[model samples]
Target: MEYKNNGHIRVFLVGHAISPNRGSEPGNTWNWAWELSKYTNVDVFAYPQHRKEIEKFILEHPRNNLRFHWVTLDNFDPWHPEKGESGLRFHYILWLRKVYKIIKNLIDNMQEPIVVHQVSWSTVSTPPPILQGVPIVWGPVSGGQVAPASFRDFFGNAWPKEMVRSWRVSFYPLILGWGRRVSSLPLILAVNRETEALLRKAGAKRVEFFLDCGVPSGFGLPKPQEVARPPGPLRLLWAGRLDFIKALPLVLMALRRVRVPVELLVAGDGPLKLQWQSAVQRLGLSDKVRFLGRIPWDKMKEVFQEAHAFVFTSLRDGFGCVVLEAMSFGLPVITLDHQGVGTFLPADAAIKVPVRTPEETFQAISEGIERLALDEDLRLRMSREAWRFAQEERWDRRAERMLALYEEVLSHAHRRV
Candidate 1:
């Protein structure tokens, strides 16, 4: 295990959307960088859009082995609408030829020795050119590699709602494309079992379990009510894009059914903001619902903490990082069972809603509310359970596991040498 000749192992983490504006992804990026830094020299190579944030983050948290390198994209990476993603799939791949060399040179030029590791999304098409002999890992929670379509007709069409759903329907195809792009590369750390299976199916030689999302023991947020919040007006907080996929209307309808005086604090702004606001006005729930646009990450804990429970009504998520965040604060989540993250969560952290257009969500929310209200003991139990789980999955714990893996991977590399 003498790495004396190997010199120092350096891991280059590439995350395109690591910026302040992108709260979700950067949270993941910072944790990945922080974790990898523990085991090896981690140079955080990210898109330049986040230079300021990355610089600020690194300064606040200086690490011995971990470094941050932000990659500026003169032009955004290719996506579907840019002349048919499927058509230029092979052409888009050619861009990766450069990716390989840039990384390879870093490996070759290392004073002692080095290793390159990828944590999340890298815009490059194939394995970095220099990684031919190196162990490269990409994606624990790859964006685009989704499960097989149940039926061609099943996916939401530009439903009348899509026009008004306050979501980026256009991004759907792009999200899909991003997956195929990442899956093409070799993955060293697969975020979850589902993603691991996909990476293997796509021909990755080796994969490891490394969750893309991490949670702190506490986000400086208040714990959810030990008992449901006294049963009067339900202050339902619906954070995230008010877009189509979130099925906001179903949330609206579910709230609408509740005779209880309920208020919905809809946070996070998106394209269909006005449309959703208008719909709420149309439904005459003006007093019942309020749209609180994007709250700062540091302050988000307040919104979830103040609320009785966290509702993740989204049709999908990589692993619902927010869900983990919410649970870390001791809030129970009510979400759909169909998606990867939903099923992935411990049953104790959530109330699973059967996926149905509006009826199931409606009944589920209503039932969840009533159950929480009627059984304070149950609410307290769930709250304690969620908090315990999140602490167990805290970033520090996750990072330790990652460091162990890097040691193993590096050990393997040294043996080969």
Candidate 2:
């Protein structure tokens, strides 16, 4: 895994998807790929053919210093006639082994210092421990946003698992075995403190901190001159999935008695779409809210521009990228301070509320929003400061930090020789 000094920092990033879908999961891969491609000669190694149009369009329009390598896997689709036709876990195993072998071959072929950044979760195989000697970065690899009940104490309520066969899944036999085993890999570059902590709990050593999400520009907010009386009370904005773990109802319950006007704009959609609509109707505060369904990328800025503050009340988040996007808009953030989302936010830029009872959630939102709404001066000040911080946190910064970490490690590996 050692390398010579003169070669390009050839990066091999593996992920489930790089297209950056609306969900948090896709953001994890896309953000990292787009950022990393900026600093190094990079190539993305992804799953079998996803969409033909995307594949063809991307192949023809590759970015500078970046390439795409699609590793076709015999994906297990029950409805497909070819499903189980492989007669073994051959495709899955071969996919993992062949990809690594390809990376090793690439190193040999190009004489480049290879960095295998493996996005580990429930499916993708953990890179061989020996690959760590080559400066590998591990994940924002959240297989599912909703944790099973066993992990509920740490991950909040049981997460949505419509595709994961429910909590009937045995942790030891499946996820924990693979994910923990992967975490135990030496010299893993982790995304956040919570992830690092989890890896440590899983016996991970030689790990370093990294921010997985990308915060794009335009810290949008209503103009001071245009906004009158700040809409009274605490005007709040909470965006993300409408799923159960999102704790949308909990956020609603918390803001129930607040004196300020609390607004929760449910942005993304999921299985719990109907339930959220029902809850909103029952709450009788529909006037204070709006559900801008599946917002287009170009219009997200307009939405962020309208809000005063971003509130995230998810039970567990793997580096809440949306909060970063919110901060980029210079909206002050108030979020749960346990597990994933809490880890990515810098304390000075946002409000971190402890994940205690639902009461605390209510208190934080009610009071926090009012404080911002009433004090125009405070909003202006925080907005300016928030954007300043967000500017420094552009995905390029994250990519550079990772590159520096990789170069440092690679240098040491070479010196030891």
Best by TM-score: 2
Taken over the whole model, the C-alpha lDDT of each candidate is: 0.61, 0.61
Structural similarity to truth (TM-score) of each candidate: 0.74, 0.77
Q: Which regions of candidate 2 fall more than 4 Å away from where they truly are?
A: 1-7, 20-34, 48-64, 74-94, 120-133, 141-186, 216-234
In lDDT terms, how accurate is model 1? 0.61
Stretches of model 1 off by over 4 angstroms after superposition: 1-9, 17-22, 52-64, 69-99, 109-114, 122-130, 144-197, 205-209, 216-218, 221-231, 259-261, 281-287, 411-417
Error of 1 at 120 (Å): 4.0
Tens-digit lDDT track of model 2 for 137-248: 6654432233324324322333344325333322322455655556545466555554465455556657665555556433343232223334444456777777766777
